[model samples]
Target chain A: MGVNTEPDVLPEARVIAVAGLGLIGGSLARRLAECGRRVIAWNHRPAPYEQARAAGIECVDDVTDLARAVPDVLVLCTPLKAMPDVLAKLAPVLDSRTVLTDVGSVKGQVRDEVKAAGLNDLYVGAHPMAGNEFSGYAASDPSLYDDALWAVTFDECTSYDRLLVVIDMICEGVGDRIIAIDDDTHDQAAALISHMPHVVSTALANELAETPSRNIAQALAAGCWRDMTRVALTDPDRTRAMVEEDAANVAQLLHHMSDRLESMATLLESGDDEALAQVRDFFAVARPYREYKARERGGAAHESVTVRIGGDEASWRDQLLASAKRGEHIMHMTDRTHAIAEIRTALV
Target chain B: MGVNTEPDVLPEARVIAVAGLGLIGGSLARRLAECGRRVIAWNHRPAPYEQARAAGIECVDDVTDLARAVPDVLVLCTPLKAMPDVLAKLAPVLDSRTVLTDVGSVKGQVRDEVKAAGLNDLYVGAHPMAGNEFSGYAASDPSLYDDALWAVTFDECTSYDRLLVVIDMICEGVGDRIIAIDDDTHDQAAALISHMPHVVSTALANELAETPSRNIAQALAAGCWRDMTRVALTDPDRTRAMVEEDAANVAQLLHHMSDRLESMATLLESGDDEALAQVRDFFAVARPYREYKARERGGAAHESVTVRIGGDEASWRDQLLASAKRGEHIMHMTDRTHAIAEIRTALV
Candidate 1:
């Protein structure tokens, strides 16, 4: 099926107001500024305001200043708990023509809050599935949106043309393969894929920390351990808000995950080789399913690589002399402790 | 408490046999060759032998050749299941003074197998906590061993001086972080840190596969999914071996992990804000543990960074030109995309 490609090419945006200056807000501001929109950024704290200014962004320190900007598009990039009041305060500044969207984790709660505030005509919910372990404006990559899934939640009230304009603008920024779903389903799925994993990883990390094995685990942990528990290092406040806001769905999925792990444990405990073999068989069935979904996100199976480094700095210089004298692989020599270089030969 | 510094340095190895030519064996061969040892490499297949030959390694196609070579040290680098027979066959070659070690996961089983085969004095179990997803001789780097842990297992019959010589050899190949642990404790710890996480990641990927919302999930799954499910994509045969060999310990750890996740689900289902808060608090306590470990891994993290690309190959060259003409921060390029040669600049 062909994707809809119609662009709502409005002549200009009057003003674009961003609700926060975390990673998303900062990126959106930069992108809007690139598109020649007069961007006004708002942050509650003095910290991000300075960061915004350093980036040559025009900053509004207060909500009233944001209201005065009279944005044609008001993007809420605040944490979930902070979204309701920000939406409420922006309602008076917003009109039917003004477009609003959020970069929040849970869409259903935010969508309900927007509708409850009686600004349904001016609002939609969106989640840009891109992030780094690091937060704040410094970590915001312009290409963070590229190849990510920007899930736009729509109901009957969402204007077709307005959605197109927002989609085009997002595509111009850090764009990815976009998926459309309604608020409820989008929220439930987000809980399953995103929020639930965070909760699981954090809980696992916590269990590791609480065990006597924690000390030994630290020594034994490799890249796999680091990768598996990475989300455990996320800002607790941000994840707490996400879990609390979408408690029911996260709870449901967590139950399902727990049950699956429990079954796996039982099979392992029984020491029945056939049962354990079945666990591997089950994963074989699951692998292709995951591969299919990952492809939709424009990702492929990651390219595995091997790297070889030769010589310490002192030995490197000696190697350079040895290679030059012996006419070997060493070229363009530089001296440093453990020089960053790649192997030209299959050293092993 | 000071570690023993005056441990015996091994006499130059007159002959050495490596039973596999994957990451560990390839690396061992290279180091042994560099250390002036006569190294004979054997692989289960001939392809790695070809690559080893190209790298100037002496390759022997048959395991019987190992008996005639009569290597002073036999470092078995095969999978766990293949260890016992490889050890038994190598027994004919082992002299009274011969020191032996095997680079395998789950040291306890291998330790027992070697003892059962009447080579207790000659055998030591070693696990090098370093690897990439890629395998085989071509992917092997001599430097892959640098600055990683070599967990060495010691038992009642192990000679002090012989242990030190093996430890010295491993330290030279890898790093000086040679942790000495009993076989049982090592197996239990491996269960916690390595095997348990594999089960968790595989089950998680499986869970995501079965979810009705996978279509939306595929788009939204980012680094978290990639990180959590990495072990899911690991070689199934290797995974099965690790799981079966240490079934009891892995089962115990899985029970603990399942219980933690269950409680998290319960809290979410009951909408216990306080309990949810506690879960977040638990993460707060756990995040530092991982952060501390990351700091310890140090330069190993840099090993994974892709090379940066810039200049004429940039896709955003036109955009950069336009932004530069418009007096933006397009001149302040920092990070560059390696593949696309795109210079990422913050637009001021």
Candidate 2:
């Protein structure tokens, strides 16, 4: 097999190594390779080895091979629970010149682990706010991070210029927009936006599980329940691990959500016209705020055309992207169900 | 100047009078007209009168005119709060031959009102499970009730044959499927399937309204939050009226939801691995059940193509339906946002 050497088209002379070839790592490696960089990938499992080799990416059989490659940048893409063990094992192999970053959802725990391993000076935290229902190396796509927001948390002791260079390199390689914030702030924001929503969704689904008329109700469920509970379809083990790690934050947010739900229940139960009016006013404020936020986020601006194609969505997305002109892109694609797939594309 | 008389093409020699020319009333009138039936509509408001008249449906100025024109059937399409008053007003004018029905979401209250108005023998409760985000006469379409589920509840004292004939006429006029249910069961099912979901959606939107990072979170919100909160964009007064009328059922459901949410919070807070695994198992059951229900509902079977056409969605939907082939239909059409309208059509 032909090994992927560093290409001349790359502006900087930097070797990149990606550990744990899951969706994120695999996608990163694919994007970096496409950007004319030498990318070496390592995975504990053997399933991704053939695919990585077939993609012309060098596969390291052992963690020591990662240090032997002498990569200037090392990206850890392991699951949250596996991170500490992986970090500890690889700490001996990492050199001072190797700048480390991760694509974990939570930043605080990773930051603590890096500090505990005496690698704070070489570590920066990153979370690409991009994912789909599917996971693993087989589902990896080069354009997964295109135009996605990447949250980066930097340590005070780390060299600012060196970290910035590495961030810029990754951003350029994957076409991701950077959002710099502190680790705590990142966790707080993520709890509200991501983890909290997941808990709400899962809990809602669980509620439905116990309802007597759930089957009938599900038959009649419109867009609301479908959207609200979409995240419940994710891998239970993976989600369980994430929620366990961020249990404190998730629990706090769930408590807040419970308070809000209780308030609504109390208002409805009050049987007072004024309380009903108050509830109405509450929704009146909510309606415009939600709409405004949706509009502000460019959710309402797309001129999209959705068509049903019965096959692999990624393949169809790739086919469309290849032939699409400037300003044309897939706005959204639904998970395949009943041998049918829906793809919404925004036409310029 | 013209009055709608009996049309010969209709199988039954019946005149259908529809009171309240809002979305449901106007659409019913229009569809009845299209089905070669004489439809006379009466609206308390002046705005819809001209529109109804323009659509070739005769408009009545008063309740007496509706009684005079409605020799066979009188359908009450007024709001929940106005229903008792309207029924009392029209009760003085109606004869025993007239079959009375309504398009109300809550059936128990309407049944009570019908009984109080001494029209129980002539009344049959009907609630069509079809609606759009928009309302009023201007948003009405002839195909609004086509292939939609129409829940019909009957009182024990009512004339079965007469009510069935009227129900058949209405079903034939609008091409709706009949779902026979008791009034109380109808209310309970509707609360779970429709009203409760609406409340959940509104509360979620209210949560977003109170969030400090709402704008940022909304920017990152994927299909989950968007779908879950879509109903929050509806008219607040109409929703408030419904919620108030069905406050008891809604409050009970909300209390149940709160309990479920609290249980989840307690589990997560407990930080017990077994508890977390139980929560995960909860989701495992929920996810498959939801998917199975969605699949059983034919949610995954649609072969729809959505195109962005910037204009009035109702007008576009009407035009498409008017020219569509025997099996084709408009599955859905989204409201115009940022000057872009999306219409999804199913090619049979």
Candidate 3:
């Protein structure tokens, strides 16, 4: 099952079937189609199915119909909980050549399920670290994954070349930066970066909700509170679905975070003259780490080009889209004033 | 001494002496000067004094000189730890006619010190809920406190009318929204909105710093982490000084936050069938609270008007300042493409 180490071979343009046309799936499908790859989408829910169809995407209504389409690459973009069941249903139709992948938050569980279903050779677990507070098919954009980190996990026995062929196509199509790690490593990193942070944000939000003077406190809420709790605005059901798949990792990180908070409280409560100094030291160490992170993240492989334009509000918006299409990676457009607009483009 | 407050009587425009020309002090001084009020600034540090002097603000080198000026309103803008000593040194010269106030995060300590000095009637504790990550006199802007929340705490025996007169004067001068809370209430709110969150952010940053994959994680860090840890980038000395004054409240809130995190971790680790549902419910309650806060904040008394202009980058910046002066409350200007600019002004 080991992949052949062929550097120059690109995979053929076989039909790519995307299961679950939510934000990730819809965006991937749109991006792949835009890149001249044949993309067919499947959605269990009629709303997203209709959305995909309305967006000019070819939609397969049934699992059998999707399996019959015989896609060379099958991407499972369903929620974490739904992936196992979806995999079970699709397993019967998958062949050795049909490389299977997924865009789930936690990869360990999905990897285990794929192994249990005897599809390890065909599976490569992937998670693209790209999304917003908004979700679903309607919010999907073709460039959602542009310049974003995409973590892919491969087992030792997996066909690395074959998996890379598929991944490289998707990455190239969507302009994603590839980050290869094992399933366990990927899940651990996800806990650190995504899952634990979500829990922390929710806890902060919950505490604020329980405050008696929440109304007054809310009036006093500034940039710090807003930034700390922005992720708490996500759909509750979706967040639950995501967190549950990686519960143990999330819980472990939360426990560690709790310990950290307790230590800070203890230092503050010590009443020693040096207590403030200790607190100062704690933050002093953390400051550089955060600054380093910010600096490193900013230095990622993304080149931004700013373009200036002038127009009315509607015209500015229209010009923004036009510039985005022409540039192919416009990240955002700021309306400087009524007459001036700045379009920031991230070159692929 | 009770301040004689007659309904038709306005306090005479006496000199305003602002001590410690840091970010808050410098901005207040600039705003006061811009509002046609004579402002004299004092800074213990030579650099800030020089900066204030360079900014065309009147600076008093000595505390007695400031007192000799006989300011009707004296605003102490030093750090929390330095406030008591600064107040003690200036208490002898501050007569009953001069209404004394200090802008400090923790109001209880300042309130106690003022009472200890028998200057209760002449003292009001204030905490302006405004600042940027950038600090010092150099970062000060005349509009720093525009549309910002300013918490003012008055003791029970204080002359309410006189305090209100001084507060109204200061608030109007700085363009801050008045949120009158008691010492304890203000501290508690400050802990919830500012201090505890800083600890949480530092803890999170510390955890990342301790990770072996920190360098990689830093590379992969995105918006959520960026927002959550932004305040962690501030000067540790300043943060410690602020937190130490409000240590008890901050510690208590941090303990509460620890408990919340512990509970969330417990729920995640329980392996209950309803765990996902419970998590969903937890977040659902919090989402609306945060949304309400954001909506209310947005609805604060500020009307932003956008004006369009076209020019080169340097000329656009100049035009932005010119428009801001003409508009009187330009909150921000965006550089829309190279040709056009948008200036957003908040109407007074």
Model 2 lDDT per residue over B26-105, tens place: 88888888887788888988788777777788887886688776556788888787887898888888776677788888
Highest DockQ model number: 3
- The better-scoring model by DockQ among 2 and 3 is 3
Q: Which residue ranges in model 1 land beyond 4 Å of their true spot?
A: A1-15, A37-72, A130-143, A146-148, A156-165, A168-177, A290-348, B1-15, B38-71, B91-93, B172-176, B294-348
Query: Which DockQ-derived CAPRI band holds candidate 3?
Result: acceptable
Highest TM-score among the candidates is held by which one?
Answer: 3
Worst 10 residues of 1 chain A by lDDT: A339-348
On the 0 to 100 scale, the lDDT of residue A31 in model 3 is 81
Residue B90 in candidate 3, Cα distance off native in Å: 1.6
Which structure is stronger by TM-score: 2 or 3? 3
Question: Per-candidate TM-score, first chain only?
Answer: 0.71, 0.76, 0.76
User: Least accurate stretch of 10 residues (summed lDDT) in model 2 chain A?
Assistant: A337-346
lDDT, model 2, position B175: 62
The deviation in Å at residue A177 for candidate 1 is 5.3
Cα lDDT listed for each candidate: 0.64, 0.66, 0.68
